[model samples]
Target chain A: MNPVVLCTVARMMAPVLLLFSLVLTVRGHDSPGGGFVGGLLATAAFTLLLVAQPEELVRRRPRVDPTRLAITGLLVALGSGLPALFLGRPFLTGLWAQVPLPGGGALKLGTPQLFDAGVYLLVLGTAMAFILGLLHGEEEEAREREG
Target chain B: MTPPLLLTLPLLVCLGSAALAHLCPRRAWPRRGVALAAMLALTAVGLLLLVEVRRQGVLAVQLGEWAAPFGITLVADLLSALLVLIAGVMGLTVVLYSAATLAPELEAGAYYALVLVLVGGVCGGFLTGDLFNLFVWFEVMLGASFVLLALEAKQEQFEATLKYMTLSLVGSAVLLTAVGMLYGVAGTLNMADLATRLPGLERPGLVSTVAVLFLVAFSLKAGAFPLFFWLPASYHTPPVAVTTLFSALLTKVGVYALVRTFTLLFTQDVGLTHTVLLVMGGLTMVTGVLGAVAQYDVRRLLSFHIISQIGYLLAGLGLLTQEALAALIAFLVHYIFAKSALFLVSGATARASGTYDLQQMGNLYRSHPLLAALFFVPALSLAGVPPFSGFFAKLALIRAALRAEHWLIAGTAAGVGLLTLFSMMKIWREAFWKGHPQDPAAKQEAPSSVNVGWGVLGPCAALALVMGVLGLGARPLLELADAAAGQLLEPTGYIQAVLRRPP
Candidate 1:
């Protein structure tokens, strides 16, 4: 099969994996799974796409930088602390809210879950950065030659 | 602001700075400015902690009103808060140094980001009241450090980081598993609650096992004798600024956690903890100085000394007295600043000479007399020379140990101090006095003097001066350290502080 077709197939599966990861994360407080394992599953889905496609597709993208992923994760995590600060609670205090989903049912989201996702993205991005940076070394012509 | 909020504000600032830093353009100076501002804010928080600790006995902040045993808590006693203050000072110096010394292609933005997270994690570890929270903070610091270790991506860095990552991951896993087991048996993760509840529970074997597991994890992080190979290998690869920060702070955090836990929750097992600590302390001091004796590189020698100095802190904790604790705190504060200053000077030396290896670097006393003098005082201080902070710190520890009648350990530590002097003098002889043979190509390749920013040097010089002042102000600080240590050892104070009533 052509690599392009293989990649397209994996792209279609990414959302399903992501949804499952969220489910696992939501249930993690009482269950065996938490942000780390759930995040790994989501990262693996992205990794599958990179393997199927050319390196350039992943390397040249703007948001793929591992450092940025880490930064974003930290921002989300810190934002979780904001509610606590205003309410005079401790840092990383879990805040709660209920909102309506599109299907007329309530969805629960909390600061802990948001913090979980941030950790997920942070770890995934960090692991991916190391893997991708190594794989894409050939692309950094100017960087290597300078050294 | 409340004490917990005081700690949280710094993390929040770090988080914001991490974002603002990453958003800066690749060629921009804006990221450095933002990081500097964030660091200044953190220092302000540390100062606030000082004022709070002086006013109140110690401060506590519980999350979500769930109370201890159910919710996490953050505490800042004099000991932890003082360490936080030292950490903030070290961080600001390193950031200033980084702005000046960071080589091109080092990804300055990412470097600063990692530094911020590492700082936040260390402070978090210092403040958290729950055991599980402590484990989480340890992983946070280790994970950030792992990235920083491997970020430069050289051949040696790959091998070194892989070693560091594997060891750190295993240590963290061990730590988390121990947390799980402690939670299962004790049914609580809060440190104060554990202290009150633990001695009453009758399961000595399980407690001992969990304690041992924690010891191994912390020892691995502390780079104690048997577990120290990773420190020497990985520390020399990073830019000197990063190495300086890591050398000054990382393992010391491990030592702090060990001192905290053993003093608080595991005091019932004093015979076991004290004996093990004494033996490890003796071995670590000897082994570290031996490693230093064999090294020809300036940074590697300093790296070895870090492990040796940790042995001193362990010895103080093992002695387990008011005076010993005071000495440990004093020594650690002095060591953090002195060690970091020496490393920054090494960066300046490396820039001028094009190598950190002493074999390649000779006679620096002539051209760079100021830099030579800058490195000299810290080296002497580290060796425990009279009138320096190291001498006072050692004298206090020895006095405490003798008072406790641990003659063998005290004698061994003093002997190791002599070896410490020997290794430092070796560097002085080779790097500053003997001098390098001039090479035209190497001179052309030398890092620019602009890279050795006065902003960086000024902080380091101020830090060294501060260590001297700490010796002068030793009485009040010693009183505070004794109070902190008493709180940790007895832990009834901490338990009451958190339980909000008598147990």
Candidate 2:
């Protein structure tokens, strides 16, 4: 019945769900999952946040404006493409660069995977932003009439 | 990298702009800019693609280099490039008009984001070479469209959108099922590969069933005749800019895919498919014009005309000649500009007078001479009046139909053009000249606040001007359309261009 505890629990799961979404996106090229499904999963995490938080508090705060989150994801995606332009390739050209991870292993980061991450961010951000914006507007309008 | 990157730019611009719009201090400015930038970027890419296709002939990008059957491919030929260009131009005009009028009322970034995704999906549909990928693009575009349509979600809009959504989902499901069955039969999702695999398949009934499913799915989306009831109900409910985008672009995506797949893969079964198309085309034109006659709303009337005009394009596909195809392409280009301009004109009028109901719009000719002309000329052009792009477009289609001895199609085309003029005049009489009587509910009450900013009117007037210019410069476009049609007839150039492997 304590909303703060519920909100904290939801917030704690956000990171875990976000990490899972990343995993889905990274292995997407080789597996059934891709950016779209991953994005939806991430959006679910945010939806949970809304559910756990009190509606009144959530309404006042303007939770992670979907529009802004979508833009940030797009920027990351666009940023990944900048490396291609530097290499004298066209915009959004996918380039794979292998980075040496700790313990004598390598981590591979590339334009395509980054693009997927961007897509994940975009879908999640847009979906949640739209859902909340709509919910907030209706709630505010109702509150005004009641007052 | 080049092909895929160019294709992805529109999507990026669309998604990126929406994201950025939220950060803008003046939300209206960013929303407008996002739409404007996305439109300009798409048009520029289209031009670049046209030049590249001309120089190199069909350009293909194997997304992730996983090869054709395994990975997705974006293939651009003269027709696909031309369609993308048309989408870009229409998008630019609608977005600008939206910025001027609707953006202020909209919840900033979400509206722009949905629009961007819609644009991205259209480009994907135009460029995709794989059957499965085409289905994915279709879903992407339709999903975004549902959000846009239901954005307002008034009682009427909710009703219309629910019907639209249910029907569209059914179409998508049928398309997915067909794709699944095709994959089972051919062992590949690549369209060209499917074509190669199809000739040897022994199951005629299965192929026929699948082909019919494709027709039903595309025709439903295309708003062709029987499946078109949803278009009139829903298109007019949204703000003018949204209506213009959907009316001009979305249905055309269905028509484009239908023509592309049938031309390339299902050519062997044209006897059944073409006959179906021809019958639907005739019914679509007659019924569409009839619907237009019955409607009082400017946007709904234009929506009806969209179905009639689409009928002409379908007629061309049924004929399947080089000339017919050329004429269809030319008509489509003209329709995109003209139809969008007409809707924008309606939006401008609504903003000026605070009503979409034609019965209420009064004496616009006196108060706003420029706006009246802006709306009038396109209405005339849409009716296929002489010296306009619509006239030339109709002339080409008529000539092609006659040459092929498709007498019914030729007669129906001309008849529909006349009916189109009738509906245009009805709007002219009711909205511009006589105007609707003051509403008792709102008459005594001060008029609803209307901000007729330059941001809105300027874009609409500019688009109307472009329609006139496109009408005037029909010769060059006609030649280009002919060339594009010729290329589609022999798709060897497209296949060869994409398959330019290391050897």
Q: What tens-digit string does per-residue lDDT give for candidate 2 at B267-311?
A: 778789899999999999999999888888788888889998889
- lDDT tens digits, residues A1-147, model 1? 788788888888888888887788778877877778887887777778778767677656665566668668767766776787787766777788899899799988888888887777777777777666676766544553553
- Compared with the real two-chain complex, what DockQ does model 2 have? 0.27
Output the worst ten-in-a-row residue range by lDDT, candidate 2 chain B: B440-449
At residue B134, candidate 1 shows an lDDT of: 90
Candidate 1 DockQ, CA atoms: 0.45
Worst 10 residues of 1 chain B by lDDT: B441-450
Give the interface RMSD of each candidate: 2.3, 3.8
lDDT of 2: 0.80
lDDT of 1 by residue, B1-503 (tens): 87668756655676577677776776437777777888888888888887787678677777656676677777778888888877788888888888877765564437877888798888888888898889888888888898898787788888989988888888888888889998987989898888888888789889988888888888888889788888998898888888988987899889998898888877778899778988898899999988889999888888999989888888888888878887888788778877887888888888766788898886566656677778877888888887777788888888888999999988988999999999988988887777355643433343233344475567667767876776667677667767777766666666767777211
| Model 1, residue A35: C-alpha shift (Å) | 8.7
Residue B291 of model 1 has an lDDT of: 86
